[model samples]
Target: MATFRKHGKSIRVEVSKKSNLQLATFDIITQVREWTALAETAIIESKSTDIVSNKTVSDTFERYTEEISPNKKGAR
Candidate 1:
């Protein structure tokens, strides 16, 4: 699972998963910042008509993929 916490001007992201030996935590601040910047770029560069049509369709498919396949067993 992932948890996001906001404090003042910064955001904190925590990712956790279960394991047999120990628990691991990753502090992914830079990754979150990069993703936020990419999302902002996508919104800014997208045309209104594109957003109303193709952009919405693409976003829906992306969300569906993320929801169903967040990880892969052999992925690195």
Candidate 2:
């Protein structure tokens, strides 16, 4: 729950804090929602990048072991 107060012609809003209420609180609410959406987008993008890098590393390791292992031993 956010409390709203008059800030000149605009509204001031804070969550878990008390202030005088004003009709301009609607604008403050809109700004808060926008910030939340931006944060969510960043988190999703980071996860997607991590998934791609992990797959590339696993594939490279498999190739190295397969092609180079045969040439390393000389028991015969």
TM-score of each: 0.30, 0.26
Q: Best by TM-score, which number?
A: 1
lDDT of each: 0.50, 0.50
Query: Candidate 1's residue-wise lDDT over 1-76, tens digit each?
Result: 4456775566665433331111222256776756545544444555213323346777888986787555756444
Report how far residue 69 has shifted in candidate 1, in Å: 32
Candidate 2 residue-wise lDDT, 1-76, digit = tens: 4455677766665443122221224456577556445444544445323234356877888987877766777523
User: Candidate 2 lDDT (Cα, whole model)?
Assistant: 0.50
Q: Clash pairs of candidate 2?
A: none
Q: After superposing candidate 2, which stretches have Cα over 4 Å from the reference? A: 1-27, 47-76
Give me the runs in candidate 1 sitting further than 4 Å from their true place.
1-27, 47-76
